[model samples]
Target chain A: MRGFGVFTTIALLIAGCGGGGGHGDPNPVQPTSTPAPAVTATPIPTVNLVLQLSSSVGVAAASFSVGYEAGRGSFSGSGAQAQCQLGSSDTLAVNDDDAGTLKVAILPADPTRAQNLALPTTLTCSFDETGGTVTTAGLRIGDKKIGVIDGNGVVVAGDSSRLDVR
Target chain B: MLLVVAAVGHCARGAYAAGAPSCADPNGDGVDVIDAANVLRAAVGLPSTCASAPAACDLDGAGGIDREDALDVLRRAVGLAPTRDCLPHLQLTEVVHDLDLPLFVGAAPGDDTRLYVVEQTGHIRLVKDGTLAPTPFLDLSRTISSGGERGLLGLAFHPQYVATGRFFVNYTDTAGNTVIAEYRRAADPDVAEPTAARVFFTVTQPFANHNGGMLAFGPDGLLYIGLGDGGSGGDPMNNGQRLDTKLGKILRIDVDAYPTPPSGNVGGGDPDVWDFGLRNPFRFSFDRGTGDLYIADVGQDRFEEIDFEPRATGKRNYGWRITEGTHCFDPPSGCNLTGITLPVAEYGHDAGCAVIGGYVYRGARIPGFVGRYLYADFCSNRIWSFVRDGARLTSQVELTDDLDPTHALGGITSFGEDAAGELYVVDGPTGLVFRIDPE
Candidate 1:
């Protein structure tokens, strides 16, 4: 009986193992028909811009120009920049080269007092493409920058720059 | 003194002798008896330089002691305008009193009247005859919070305080709520104790900053309380324009009668909301003589405004969210300038930072400034005065240099007055008080 039982158990175990292998063995390995493509990074574009001021008072006229790619693209434009003369008539202009060079000039209507006026020494510019909101800070004419202003022509900020005179 | 007078009289009558310098001609111009008597009085006090016979009697400096000197003496005696040299030099007296926890002050109707000062942490002090009473007139500091800008921001004695002995106080509680409590002094006019305390109205403040704690009874006898627009910057919640919320507005309520019975029942549902659209009306006062109301509304930035409300008008809107001092401040619709009541006077941040409302000087002492309304700034220590004629408000003038410039105490938080119509200013930072008088 023992010999018959051992032979039957070994046969059942072999059948179970064969059934498990049969259920798990299908589609063990597969190959891809096509390969994925690699991605390439893009570079950002840069531009050199210049801003110029005309008359120093009463909605003073101003002009701006952009030079990009070593003079490959040169654009000259005119628009109003809310720049006013500090206590008198002063004007300012800027020239920028796509080669990373910026040149700024302050013209004083009253040249005799130009030395006394401190022209702004720094300028910060920022813009938003979606909102079209461009803001500039630290803009100086001679050694001074316009401090405060209202919707009216009244300048609440201090004006020590001789370049503010239009 | 009597013997000298008698000798002078004898000389004037020529009784002593004929050559007695003709008795110095008491009436040098030879006027009548009354004129001669006046001239004699004037010449009697002449010094030795002027006492050279007839020239001595020329007290008028008009060449003689004649009718002119007599008239001059008479004018001087009757309190009429005297000549420049004869005018008496005026002197001023300063009286400083030490007060314990002087919280708020109010004045009633008469001369030689008393001033009521409220001490934070509770207790009402009475300054009568320029002396503070030893005991407190009333005490309620036990229930007061005494926190930021809280604790007895305002006190108003009913116009008929003499008869009614009733007064009101606006204070903040432990929970940071503004309460306008009414109390009646005991039968004894001097003591504030033995009084009945009653809570007339209570307002729950969302935040502490803009509580608008000033309470004043307007000319109409209605209590007007100034509440700040719930205190965060920029009016983030839009509390000023919304009428349903009482947060940024000056509220008027009739405290004479309870809307409901003595029980906890409420009736008529707040018929007291008088005017709205205010940021934080720090201090507001009505002209004691005229009923016009002047409000000092503290602004957010760039501007401090003084709003004027004529007594005749009732419902006037002072634009808050939509406008600040006649200018568009917020975005979208900056300011609706059409129907809003504009401020009579406004100063930029350069001149003054915050506006402190003051009383209109109706006192008799300064007759020239009788109808003018006086106000000051907390930051710049500038004193300003405005005159309103009919519906027009004149430009304000700086009344600086009249009071002690050092008395501003960093910032002026409140202005008070005594019974005689004298004005006082309270400095918030230094906790000092100054009385404004004629220079």
Candidate 2:
């Protein structure tokens, strides 16, 4: 019954997550576009948000997306390189439109987690912290609302994680 | 103009006009913006412009039509049932090598060339392009218990593994406890990311033996697991008839973490369990064709039995200490079979000491085994089968006569299938993965 789909997820960010003052923003990872060769943008001030899970209750699949206003920013692939144990059979998708948005998705190779989970998991993302009035649109765990953590380590319900992406 | 892929096979049911399949196109065709509009009317009980068929409309099976049925129809169109009605033979052909105490075998969805074999020593080996890969797909021996009915016990691939590359396993961890974990194939698609292991669930075992560990994705898409009564002899903990513990029961959970019941047929709504009252249901299988389940529970001192149930007979209690198979076990005189669901067929120690549950042959190669439930014994090392009509056992025969003894099957631990629905057999001692071939 829980559908953490693209549109539903987008709607969560747009409708549920509210914004705040402070030019701080969580830098999200931006994926590549068409045949345009690789080019790093001008250095932009960014804040990395690390969401820590209270329990590694087996995350089979997950995704996060947010929209903001700033000079385009992206993730540094900076935190916990192996934050999650993804299988060669798993799928990790990232989408960051140069405009002002970013999305991250990970699907595990097994759903039952018969091997137990990599407990106390953490998600580290990056984006322009100065993106004027930055806020989270949505965060999902296993396509369901299990809470998410802000860079401040403050836990927020997945469906209503309106904390400043900063 | 929107050309929808999910829109084609996935449609809204019940809301269709008379005699149609689903809501989107009614005729079970592609979807359009107005598809929801056309179906919405019928769902709300207002007449619909789309055609509706019995398969889509009469979903509740209550001999009536309503909005709930309409909503259910829509859910059904999203996921279709697997193919059934396959008749296989009751024979065997040796394949694969000393799988190292191979406990279970499974093929990834949509992948026909590859098969995964799980060994009791905590290693999962891959059989690709007709041979065992040099490297292990997974190695959990460092964390799993390796001796005496322990180690890796069960394996099941995600129904959508072709697109998900996911699979589940049941094993006894180093702590001497039962554990169910999930692992994904690494970037190589062949090897698993050992570090990516995540524990889905775990249970502390009371004893070493009877650590019932068998997992399978049900026809409903919910992950179904079979756990024994915490592994002691004669139900010492009385876990078998006790609903309080997960031991001696079959549990079901939506791995996607999505709401369950996929399409109803789930008779009980306990949310976490499907049935209970089993004694080391070491192996069980759902007939690929009918979605019916056949469970072979190991006995205590005298009997070995097989219990059969349809897709919706949820919350079943297969009389354990109270009754073994269909007869009285604990009670010497007056025992009741009243509320208890007895095994459809049972055998004595004279026939086979331990019942190794097999599958209902639904393969193309074995024309003879098409509708029969094939099973074997560990002590006698003999094979047997029976036919199931609805919930009853109609015929019983010893299949050991059909097989060639020269090619010892070792000790049958589990049976598995490939993407094409072919049959296979595995032995925990010799590690041989056998297939049912031409008689």
Candidate 3:
């Protein structure tokens, strides 16, 4: 029992480590202020995908998928869109971790007017084992390529850069 | 090593179990948009405490939680079961925008770098390398009357544009005549010399509005033209059924094959007319896969129709003044429906005002959506598609529902497709271009 408790404590500490040394806000509305876990002199196995879109038309929903080469570890995280999906802003729901598919939508959003830039969302997938190649595909902007952002602050439309898993 | 695998197995199992659908009750408010919004917030790195039932947010019950789960939950909350095959969840991504009244958009035969857009004010704008080129391909504003339903209306590139560099445009000239003219690309390959235009044919218009101005190169490499029944309501000139007028006709000419000046082609499409008796065929398209032709003919008072014909369907008379949408028009009762080609599908004003013809979903991206004919209504802003089950093209389904509740596809003027067979749509009111992408 003591050993189990110690391991649980270690796991919580890792979860509390918000990429950087700081803590995550957990406010549910404000943008999460941390980048994905950064690799130090000793590389850590984790990657984050920050997808941002600005459309002349409003964004009601969006979905995407990510894949990694073998040994890249499994990924999992849905930050805000899940809250938007379930009609609550205060709830934390990590969703869309199956087969790498993620989905989100703003219900009752504008049906006529052109929307300005929408706040970006992130898919933080944690890979336990790392070292190889990481690619992102299946961004669901109605099957069209829209703008996207990487954790390093690079934003592009349709085209994306692959991450080295080392 | 066994312990390590066992520990990872326990973690994966716990993650999946924790993400079960019942965990979505963060605030105990039941699964709702607030919860869905909370999921979105979480996915985008926002802080949310689905502390109550976090797994509820994991609608898919996958080991991890993300927006796809949120989407499934949102859909269930909204009572929508997505039928992936029946509907084309097409999303339009804007390709280009901001120009004067873009009437139609056409892509050249072989060039994938540029999209040729015809503006109603007599200019052909080029969208090259993802941005609008500063120079106009050809500006006939000085020669065209830029008013209601006139100006440079339609554009069609030569089948071998790489070799010929020649293309045809249909427009109403300053003298109020429908002009079929050909222009060649300049030596620069990016810009075309407007002065090098050769007039192919011209028909004087008695009235304006019904001037059907759409040009396309048939699969057989011949140029096809769409014309309206000579304007003033009810086919006033009785031109639709009259075998002598170019008005109310879908003309076909061997302009590229002839490679010469006009011989004043007229009646019975002698030198160039392929078919006649149409009322304002606002738009038309040829199936890139089957070479079948479709014409969206604007109705007189009641219905908007889509007429279809096989590639070799020569000498067709789509009864316009005589019949509208398979119904009697001129005589109203005794009008003969025989011999004249009929519309494959049609809708009344209760549905929309004008029809914008569209392309077949032959693009390689969406396999399930293949073979479906996509089209739209200008007034309703609704998009629809259907596949032919047999000889009859049934199974009509609405594809633009999601768009309707979130955006206005303002006045769909025309549809275009790229060299890759990807589809595009144009709305006159927004003066924008959108590509149809599968969901």
Candidate 4:
């Protein structure tokens, strides 16, 4: 049990390290403590968001929706999908409603590969902030909709880090 | 290891001593889902409490403790009797072969020597005494549409077939509409009169796929038919939840009275609709022993489900567009589950794509096999069975490895039960009819 706690702490630390540049509010608090570092400087052209998925007994499939500030930012680039660091054969689909919700679903093609995945996998995506100077943008994961299935076809409890866009 | 051998013998008995702390329930806390999980953990070499006594974990007596052992314990955990001894040493014997795309198999009442196989191209072939009949019993290829989830899909003989010489068929017409028709046997017992095809009402299909064409006579003597949710994908028509349409429902009617629906059907729907909210109930069956109904609804993307309805219950709303296999589907999250009947058992696409519902084994030939409901998949060709203990589904064991060791049974499309309650599987691609037999 203690070893599992250490593994969880390490995963959280890795997620915390990614917050160095974008500096998202890890907690669900108001964006008051830290002012936008890039608001005064040259307006940040693009902001990268990192999503971390943590499961104890590996992951076979993960599906969740991300709701972001639509007025301040819009998903950019050719493929507008989160480039997930999953198995090469995994099926990944990302759909943007253009409003605020972005539905992301990942299903491993080879189930055994998912069973052998290392814990705490990461996915990264970028969006272009156009309107006014963008500060720490509002990001929320849909509740009661997220599902992370494990190797045994059982839906296991999983955790994902909060997203903050600069 | 005399003690180990004795333990193996004790565990392989195939009967669960009620409330006795056996290998499955090592700590005697009354086996539940946790014990089932622990056995699975041990099978994968993970840290598990059952790992301490691995000998006892060998539930099937297959020389070593593996996933099958864990599955057996899971059966016990879910209030089902042990089927450890019946798991292995089963084989599929090819009874008939070399035919066009066969979709279903059946036998008339009191007719044990002959089997009737339905081909998708609108012909009912006869196999008698292990010999294929040169002439089809009934042929309607010129009149019906065939191919890709259409055609003559279902056949069911009346409960009093011997006395009435009557049988019904479900097929898609040339205009792509579902047609339920009744036919009678000719002077010869083996041949059916093609001119006797009496057409019932026609159901206009919206799309090509998801044509749920399965016909069966319930124990109550009512003819039941399965229809898909108007084809396409994800039930876009929302026909599953709609009462105005009979697209995603199990329709019941009395053939003797033409279109008169029997009493005790769910109120306030299409008079023919007995139950609704099914995506594509490709296949369903009634247990000869318990008279319960089992419907295997193929899932849209992720899950395939097995729905159960008791003999006495009617008017069940199996959640379809609202949910798929016990999870929110339409709204995608937090959908209302009120007044909905969920599946008794479900598996994801990792196991199979489409579920082919099979019958409850009540045949006398296979010992310790009765009361278990068997099912298969079209894409995976994997055969699995589970015992339903009251409302819970227990003892889900995959019989693919033992039943089809050489993979001779290819792409199972449907299962057939003879008059004597013996089961046969229909291989659509290979046109092989395999009878499940004990080795």
Top-lDDT structure, candidate number? 4
Interface DockQ per candidate: 0.00, 0.01, 0.02, 0.01
The ten-residue window of minimal lDDT in model 1 chain A covers A73-82
Interface CA RMSD of each prediction in angstroms: 36.9, 17.0, 12.4, 12.3
* Superposed model 1: Cα runs more than 4 Å off: A1-166, B1-103, B194-196, B260-270, B405-408
Give the alpha carbon lDDT tens digit for every residue of B49-124 in model 3: 3322333343332323565655555554333452112233357888888978887887887677888888999999
- Give candidate 4 misplaced runs (Cα > 4 Å): A1-166, B1-88
Report how far off residue B31 is in candidate 3 (Å): 14
| Among all candidates shown, the one with the greatest TM-score | 4
Error of 4 at A12 (Å): 99
Mark the regions of model 3 whose C-alpha exceeds 4 Å error after superposition: A1-166, B1-86, B257-269
Candidate 2's C-alpha runs over 4 A off are A1-166, B1-91, B258-271
Global fold similarity of model 1 (TM-score): 0.54
What's the lDDT for residue A148 in model 3?
32
- lDDT per prediction? 0.54, 0.62, 0.63, 0.72
lDDT of 4 by residue, B1-439 (tens): 0011112111211222233234565333554433444455556655444533343455543445666666666555433456575343467888899879998999987888889999999999999988999999999788689999999999999998888789999889999999899999998988998875588789999999888999999888899999999899988889999988889989888888867678877758688888899998889999988889999898899888888999958798999999998889989999999999988878777777898999998887886677878898899887777677774555555566557755676799999999889899999999889899987
| Residue B174 alpha-carbon offset, candidate 2, angstroms | 0.5
